[model samples]
Target: MQAQSLSYYEILHLPPPPHTTPTISEIRKAYHSALLEHHPDKSILTANDSSTPTVDEIVEAYNILSTSSLKVLYDQQLESVQQSKKIEEARFKRLIAQADSIDLDDFQTATSCVQHSKDIFAESSSITLSTGYARESCHGYPEDTCNLQQIWFRNCRCGKDDAYLVTESMLEHAFLESDNAQSDDRQILVQCSRCSTWIRVLFSLAE
Candidate 1:
């Protein structure tokens, strides 16, 4: 099975920590049960089948949990991982909610086809044009001012480096589409060139 994706507690069928920490006895019992159920010699399943984890995986899980120090460290790491996942989920939900709230009629009338926002989206600040660290590629920028204008790039969560791009003309187009009198607070939605994920590129058009 894809036991690598699962935590040690999950591998042993024991309760994960913080919410419900399994005792040493419970870990031991689960470990033995897994060995009995999945041991290569004891298992009747075909070699090609990946229904159960290998004997090595079970032993690795058991070794970590059986040790008090390692279990504590693993619990902390697991909690951090779970917290990050929750945060990402919340951000994704907010993005979805914002998308649902948009008036399709108004969006259709906008000059730029890309989505615009009056408020900043999550992670918007993380990939700022002011950073100057990201690669600058002017290839697809406005043809007339291509030399002076270049697209800024940021790494995407999909592991693609410099996948998210924001161009000077794109920001200008997004700003022109805004109906708001205040020009200091505006953002444009930019999708990763390599992935389907979208990120907001915050900027000000005010001179």
Candidate 2:
């Protein structure tokens, strides 16, 4: 099961603090509402042994928000979390701008291709271009489907080290623009044979 990401306020369906502070009574009300819906005894999810958070979680969230010391600490933590998100968003925008400046067709020369990938992908590792046939492996990036890593590299700058650059998406965009992708989202993943880091490669002219 996917990990939980919802904040305490979000789990309770109340406005985050500093915007609208939920009173102790409101917190209690929200807790009961969510508890009845997600409580283990009433929840069908318990039958399947699912990973959904339990009623204990609802009580915990309510206690944190309803208490003075705990609520202040949680609010501070939320502020830190929001600030991190904003930083990530700004970094993403910069990477998008960088990816836009790259020339995908630089594959004409090995050095040019290496330079392009480095500039656009922004990884410090050196490039080791793949010369052999495609390796038989997959990264399973898009949910369940295993996308074959197209370009096989022996010693190269491995996959994306920075979270800001959406290398997989950029590679797909570049690949579709450079070659015929046949309307398949499955073809978007690429990988490093040496480091085993997931990367993206273009489709071949042969198929």
Listed in order, each prediction's TM-score against the native is 0.48, 0.55
* Candidate no. 1 TM-score: 0.48
Expressed as tens digits, the lDDT of each residue in 72-171 for candidate 2 is 9989999998999999899756654433222223232221122234332233243223321112111222323433333322223544322112233345
Measured by TM-score, the strongest candidate is 2
What pairs collide in candidate 1? Answer: none
Tell me each candidate's RMSD, in Å, in order: 13.8, 9.8
> What lDDT does the true structure give each of the candidates?
0.62, 0.53
What tens-digit string does per-residue lDDT give for candidate 1 at 1-207?
345487778778887866787878888999999888887778787234565577788899999999999888888898899999999999977774443221112221111112221112222534333332222322233435323444555666688665565655776787788887554667777666676677665666651
Cα lDDT for residue 46, candidate 2 = 58
- The Cα error of candidate 1 at residue 148, in Å, is 42
Residue pairs whose backbone atoms clash in candidate 2: 128-156, 190-199
As a whole number from 0 to 100, the lDDT of residue 13 in candidate 2 is 82
**Candidate 2 global lDDT:** 0.53
Off by over 4 Å in 2: 1-3, 45-51, 108-149, 152-207
